[model samples]
Target chain A: MPGALHRVLFVDLARHRSWVEDRADLYSESLGGAGVAIELLREHCPERCDPLAPENPIVLAVGPLTSLYPLASKTVAMFKSPLTGNLGESHCGGRSAMALRLAGYGAMVIMDRSPTPVYLSVDAGGVRFRDARTLWGMSSSLTAGRVMLEREGGAGHRTVLRIGPAGENLVTYAGVTVETYRHFGRLGMGAVMGSKHLKGIVIAGNGDLPVADRGAYQRTYRDLYTRAVRSPAMRKYYELGTPENLGPLSAMGALPVRNLQATGYGTEPPLEGEALAREHLGRRLACSHCPTACIHLAALREPHPEAPYFYKTTFVSYDYEPLYALGTMLGVEQPEDALRLLDVVEHLGLDAMSAGVALAWATEAFERGLLDEKALGGLRPAWGDARVYATMLECIARRAGPLYTLLGEGVDAAAAEYGGDSYALAFGGLEMPGYHTGPGAHLTHLTGARHSHLDSAGYAFDQEDMKAGQSRSPKELARALLTEEARRQVLSSLVVCFFARGLYDADTCVACLSAVEKERNWDDLMALGEDILRRKHAFKAREGFEFDALRIPARTLEVPTPLGGLSENTLREAISEVERLLASGERFSHG
Target chain B: MGKRLRVVDVERCVDCLLCAFACARRFGGGGLAKSAIAVRSVGGMERGFVVVVCRACEDPPCLAVCPVGAIRKVEVGVRVDADRCIGCSMCVEACAIGAVQWDAVERKPVICVHCGLCAQYCPHSVLAHEEV
Candidate 1:
């Protein structure tokens, strides 16, 4: 921790001044990423600060393992969510972490608000606040990023983070786009950036970093690279990417179709992974240090309507989540329709999961006669109609009318305002991710931090139980889920991509950390992980989060899961057990 | 036979920068500042990447342009001598493909010696050390 990993950069946007501080002690204890970010969030953010207010600080942190190890590619972003209004934490895997680390800093904190639109230009010359007035109000995040990329002038070793019109319009579920296709895609981090009158952040640097043992570092790096390329654990992602889940999940009767109305596709699901790969998969991409290259892009070729013999080609990024949210969840029958809708959301800078669930609610509400053409701005809400959904996304991003504005607040707020709570499909104020596995998946969403399915991966656990033909008590299930979640804290704190969790096991994690820093061992790393989780919960509790007050939507209980009909009482009991376990963990007090 | 670094497939490059990392590690450190190899996207990575490195030109413009005659042609590529170099950066401008990457900290041009250390770590086989 002698070099960039020991320092923290702080930028006060309101004051238009910045400074760097050596926080070696903090980095030594927290080990960076979510661990360091949570401590910084507590120190900089006030207890009752409005999530969208200028006083709410944004913390971007990278871990010690980043840039030195393979698949240690994620940067942890901590902010008070404009969507959830609690702990807003999202991890992005792109050039974000690599660029920040190469720029010679372990972490960066953006505080206060700028009076006018601006972007922070970080380079070897250090931090400079650049005027972004002309770049503001761009049609898409890609355009804004391009404008900044040309002006800033760091082509190969740089990362440009920008938001599109949805974020500029203050859509509560908007996300920040990184590179062009990857994103810090959940929990309204983009809206928080918009509230500060910030348009983008440009990072560029190429400084050398120190290691505890150079020989050991090289050995560990080579071992990791070999495993990443040769391991069977990564073969699935290497072959078809995460979209490989589509076939298996659909076959298991766990894929949620048309807003959880049905678990299976019935006769013929129009959009299967194999078919998409055969017909449309144009390219494969990866994060900075990852070799798996799981990110897939679809090539959509269409003829120009106005002219003959003219064709237009568009590349759209696709993943299991977007395919589940925009494709199956919206009752989209054509793969082309799903890709078109995905392109619209990417252009508008909206979180596809939230946008899809909100649209699904609106479609159901329209069918119930609750939403009329006047409310919809003359557009009709119908399933499998890609054109109508595309227009609706534009309207929501622009906040075209009162009804559209409500939809911008996410499905939870929209449902509360328009009276559709029973089937709104949001857990703990955040839109649900794509999963209909069993009670474990549902319980994970309700109890996990950030309301993310990856927080615990209970769906995987549910499948294991079914395979074994064994049923565990609710307490047993809760313990198993929480234990795995607690262990994941170690991985995320190391800032490694969760996709490589199978490769970066506990022994490997300890070896990697020890290779970078001599002070940290296995016990110290485990203690740091547990402490980070506890501190996150403490931040939530201070922000007025109530564990017992969460409500399970009636549709969640109504749907027959793969394990059969799940009663409400079982989910409630699981939640109670999670609460008990969280309360019993060692307490944390701010220094 | 001597080793020569080769970009076997530009399409196979995922822009992971693992090869660049391996190049930097040759200096007994970590970072992109000292690496002699660089990978860049063609506008967008959707098309592919262009791996820029010293391809060992037979004529060698870098050797012709060096004022102090610090740069010399090697078996597979060019090598820069820090003692005789003036840090004028003429060699950087002379190279057509911008393969003569500079070491920003030392203000000297970093020409690859064709060590093939980078090719050893390239997981995708995008880079290889083949016999000339």
Candidate 2:
């Protein structure tokens, strides 16, 4: 903690009271970002507390490398999720990390509910709670973000973290949008913010961070920049962003389609990255300190239904996950329709992955006669109907009816309530992401901490393993996943973007840390990563989340992947082995 | 050779602010205060961005208007002699690009030294050094 000056800012919305506390102990041991934030939540959040209640603390923390290093620009938000009913952690990149770190604070904790709508503004000097009645109840999240951006003095210096109507109305899976594009897009963090009557948080700081060795810092910074710019991985991200995955996934017949019932969309038109770039890509965007401007904005041109000469062009950003979830996953063939649906979910502040999965479930349910037209409020639930899906998204955000309310909770809960858990398309309550590549991908979803594909990168593992014709036993696969997840704790603790994994290997990470802070060595970093992973697992266990209780949806086995038929029993056995390995306290070194 | 500052093109700027960081790095400082140039979102980033810095005016109102004779033409651009400055507001108001940043801690005007160091770091062709 010699390097980290831990400052925690606590805001009480109801009384408009705010104070700062320096908790050096948290940072000294756990470091910051996800590690420290998780510890803070465990200490502050009461067990069995209502996730959206005032008692539940919403904690946001930035890692030590934030603002000082490139691609380490993510802020981790930790709170009890209204949707997941367990430990919730979401990583978002935008101005959040830089602004928070620059504002002279390591973490922000919000407690108590506000009597009326309000937003918090934190700067280098001080913090203020501004009344947001005028900006409240806005349907469009973009409008709310714009209002805060204009009203706040830090035009380019601050991040405007705001929730849309979905959050305002307490949609169970509502996410908080940051910088208008990036989001804490899972586990109902926005709903928690809304429950506290907090609409947004704007942060700006002009304070200079102290470096132990300026010369070394400068040298390393230059070296990292050169590596980042020159790396082929970085180039792919820069040119096409994440949407580049669409083409390969589709080619391999691994793109999730029709709620995991199929892997390919039977459309003649090429709905891949090349086609998207040719037809729709308008601009590219980058997160703070990221040289790879991978975020592609698609300019969707639409003619007015009535007027001949009144065409309008709107820019909607696309990534592989959003495209998969809203497009092929929902059997949406038209790219325009997919973009429209993406726009709707984004505008309403719903998690695009969860929303798409929920829609797919509803469509399947309606088709199977489990849900009828009456249940859908006379709105037909069909795959590829963009107009109806867009309207349904609105209904979901508003919680218009019983069905919408259930759908808003996410696919697992919705399917459970509607009787389709077998085809729910969820892993541990959170919906599955786009990939359906092979056993590795499915197993990763079944066992990864957040049930996110990014966790342990099972899809990447699958791709590599397939090429090599290498196979792992259940125990070996579990060990590999757990080891990778453990190592990633170090990365996430630094809060670096996972895209820079190749660049920031253990050696490089240690070098960078030593150059700046000079206290930690490689061994210490590895041990810290393992400890953090254990702590996360402990938290999950306390919340009744058992690695054994995890369910591999029947549909995963029923539908044959391009690789082979994956068995659920094998996945479950793997989970059991992982549980044993974790219990044994055995550590595996990559080298 | 006196120091000179240059901006290449406003339209070409991606607004990554690598120049700003590079300037800060050149000074061996870890903050934006050391940077000579600034980039701000114009209206919103969706619209575009504006990179602001000293254009180094020919008449140089900054030099002419300084009562304490603190402002002078340097190799990069017009710079305020930090030792000679009286923390007066005269030159700050005179500069067109609002490049004369105030160091509240030092109570002095931080005028651009126009070293073209920022231009070297601009990955995009938004900033360039030129001889007059």
Candidate 3:
């Protein structure tokens, strides 16, 4: 069906030209989002291509379920990662998915570098190149976005994506900020865009989507909406947001603190979620088509320096990951200190997890005499020092000095250049997300496709084991993680938020896909899941990902976790089992 | 007496776009193309959102500008007779609040019928069906 979607928009930055190609098969067979994006990456990204080269293509895709169903609010971006030098896949939610879908395209492929700074304005009218020379070198991405918003013409649904000094300087962990709060946060998508001389993107459209079965569409949409809005399971997301995980994870002693030197801070660590909500909860936000406004903003009011009776209020969006990474992981106890560091990260357009981990590593290295005052340019790297951390972040974004330049390459590369590879706290070049549940968690990081905690959510597996009062064998744990990760491919393809995993199970997925696309069944989706997983693995393998060589961060093994002492051997065994299952090519059994 | 959709509190809006979808679904189609209500960020989302919908003027400025005599006042608001509408979009420009959403495909105004489907689906209760 060559409907409103399935038209892939290819934009060449060098020539300032854009063309459309109909790839109905890609959209239909793979569905959209991750499924289609992986295919685009494999087809477009050349082997051993420098990740920041103009030849590296950036593909952005929205699933068929997007704009039609609640919680199906993500847009998947695929490119070669500058940090990992591998396939980069990141999901961002906000106005991005809705704006892209309504703009009348299933996916967009951007190739080559522009001659000069430019931001692409996309709509039904097609891509228009706008000069962004002045907008370039802005202190903050927010400034660039604000300028773009004023210059935009389309009056319909809109989303603005821009990168800051970090991306412009080609910081490997720099992220492209989406409509403010949200982002394509992981893997270095921003650096690729930056290398292309692309400043930002302004997308606006409101094209109508034709419903294949009007009756089915209404029923499915309503069912999902009601489930999302009224479900008790979803309440925590909107009320306190993901920050609520802080107290519990700390209690479990699974929370990474002081750069994984220890797990969990004391019960009343100053940056607890409840205290933040009560004190500085500014506002709540929801991505388009998402009922749960899970994005929580902290209203930080700070007195302006050298200006008496004057203040500036900044709304810094925080989640469990950033709170842990920038807050407790750095031994940052004050709300002001954590929020201040986050505020700096947001403006610099750097990935919070990567930036925080970089600082944590620097502080630990300095303390252990691996780094010194001379190496830091006469600066002290201390835990919880937001002022110094903020300065370091600035230096990293600007690539100002030798040490700052190394830190910008990500901790794995940084540690490899300096000492401290054992405590680098990175898996597959991407910084570890805030989780230290057990061996399953470490195994997830080591063996998962992107090394993202969200890839397999092995933490949840560990939590489930703890609940069961017994730890599964390494092989059993590996199989469970593999199954969960494979199943997630279908959900990510549908582009549903992982938070709604329970509500949008196999049956819900089948109904939603059937209503929007062709008639779908559980078995078809299960088959698609395995295919998607295999395709992603194939891309990683072609990019030279070696399971045998994947490092299990020694720091994780040293720390006792919620599920007790986890060992490197257990992680190695689980990794081997995961490798076996991945190679078996057997159909994942459906429920 | 008739029901009217009112913004109970604009601040309560999460900008979920659920109300807009519900408005579009009222026409048995998908997308915001058919919705008579719009929610857009006020400057950036950090500030807040403005929900644009018909205030249902007592005199009805939209009714005065319909050159084809397509629009008429209902108990709560105005409704456009699609058959007679020339799609001149005079009514679209006439509504001060810009609530008369234009159906770019059909070339007509999708004025709210005050059925309150949008209000019913608003998770935040930003909108309410009020008695008039």
Candidate 4:
């Protein structure tokens, strides 16, 4: 193994001291990325710790194939979630993984809290705590990024992970904007950073990496790069990006529209990805080491309100999740209106999925007379009210008022406090991602350790079942999802984007591992992945997560999916099956 | 005639860093340590990127300013003789375009050899190699 991959960096914000530790065992046995990051989190995090407290550590990790292979671009960030109050794990692309890996550490653990606003400047030398008082409280995170681009060196080679005023206000779903387009967007890592008074973190390096076998490394890189660029699987991503799914999912009656009041747009939706691309696409970008540039930035041109002739163009990044949450889910039909709401959320650096779902609930509550206009802070929650949504989203992001503060805690918290618990869309404190496919989506949301769709991708499983024209039994479905989740841990541990799951199978991963570290087989990875997932579940269990006590939102059962109405009893059976499968897992040992 | 690598389409570059990685691979390893090419965003990514490498100047400033006479003009660009180099970095200072990449570990300037490996792996046809 490369000597550098064995190194871990630890920083205490309170003392403002930074140091590196050589733990060869951590990397050699567990491998890199989440494999080592989860172990570090277990050691650093205290039991029954406050999610916002200094006891909760933020562990950012990169894998062995990070710089050596294409599409190995993600950095896994694990912490105690301010939203879920359980295992908080988010993966970010952009230059983050490459920056941290090249900065000469496989993993970084940030602890303690700063008394004043500050940002960590990390390079090959060490970490520097710079005062960010001037940059703090900026409404737009993009403005802060621009200031950072000028003030700091390592342009192109460095990543600036920063939060906006929403984070400063401690919005529970606030996300850390990575560079300009990507994000650690789920489970509120930004809020955790906010609680610690950390404004931003910049990682940059111009360091060398040692490859165990140069010839094998070159061969593997060539094969992977060719496959990534040449394959049809990735073409969909680079061509039109993820918004490509908006039209299909909507047509298939899987898309959630108007707070799940209806599925599908019923007609050719105006906010379809192809239409958005043709009308608003400004640029396409790639994460470091990724050939497919899937990050699509839309050019939203708007004239200044007072000066009609003058215009200011903004570039907003859009995806399928945001389109569902902020667009169709709110009955937002106009492409520009959807883009505007998306821009507002992006500027605030809040998780769009959570914000959109929270807004949907608020609108429903208002419709049901559960929330009056006074409780809504004199703002009305109406469907497709983009102007109103723009203000409301801002309110939620900054926690501007009492109502907004409740909304910022996520829909579950708001519903628990207010009288709208029945329709609130959150499964386990964390608001659901944009999928309303069937029982599968809800099952994953309820049982997945992070309470996130990416945790198990049950939406895809629903689609596959739809294609086959048959649905599996509850026990069969649970076993399949658990197996997939464990297998995905392997890819996640390598820290690659899940989009590349087709490429990095067990054999291929083992082959890649041989070029950097010692030879390890597929069984070793399977065992390691299972062990890591069990540990995450163990953490969540310790943190008061009860699978049986999972809430089944009334809206989930009321809405008829493409797969027909999901049986509540079947959903419960699936949950029990997951518990059973988890118990029958083998343990991994450190060699 | 000399073969040299050049930017074909600046707008087409996706900022993947494959060209830079391929350049570093010529050094027989991974990472961007000894890469001669640099691709950086012009302000922000929305504005596109600027690719910097040896422009193969006829009367190279890097060759002219070398205090130890370690740099000499080759067919197109100049070559640095590491044995004679004193690690003064005068050549690096003299290159106005910042094409002379300094290696901190070796205390030497890493100049592009015009190997065309960067062009072959560009994925998008943002780079090109041609006889000039």
TM-scores for every candidate against the unseen true structure: 0.97, 0.96, 0.98, 0.97
For model 4, residues A381-433, the per-residue Cα lDDT tens digits are 89999999999988887787788999999998899878788789898888878
Query: How far off is residue A311 in model 3, in Å?
Result: 1.7
* TM-scores of chain A across candidates: 0.97, 0.97, 0.98, 0.97
| Candidate No. with top DockQ | 3
Candidate 1 Cα deviation (angstroms), residue A184: 0.6
Minimal lDDT window, size 10, model 1 chain A: A582-591
2 or 4: which has the higher DockQ? 4
Give the fraction of native contacts in model 4: 0.72
Tell me the tens digit of each residue's lDDT in model 1 across A254-331.
888877887867445667777889999998888997888888889999899899999998999888888888988889
- Candidate closest to the true structure, highest TM-score: 3
Ranking by DockQ: 3, 4, 1, 2
Query: Residue B3 of candidate 3: its Cα lDDT?
Result: 83
lDDT of 3: 0.88
Interface RMSD of 1: 1.1
TM-score of chain B of 1: 0.96
Report the candidate with higher DockQ, 1 versus 4: 4
Writing each residue's lDDT as its tens digit, candidate 2 over B23-72 gives 66665645554555677777766555777787777778888989989887
Tens-digit lDDT track for model 3 on A1-591? 322668899999999999899998898889888999999989988888899989999999988888888888999999999998886889999999999888888899999999999999998778999999999899999989989988995577899999999999999989999999999989998888899999999998787888788899999988888888889889889888988888888888888998998888657555778999999999999999888999999999999999999999999998888888888889887888899988888899999999999989999999999998987878898888888888998999999788999999999888988889889999988898889998878888887788899988988888888899898899888888888888889998988988888899888998988887788888888788888988888888898888888877788888899898877787888888888878889764433
Cα lDDT, model 3, residue A517: 77
Q: In every candidate, how many clashes are there?
A: 0, 7, 0, 0
The number of the candidate with the highest lDDT is 3
Higher-DockQ candidate of 2 and 3: 3
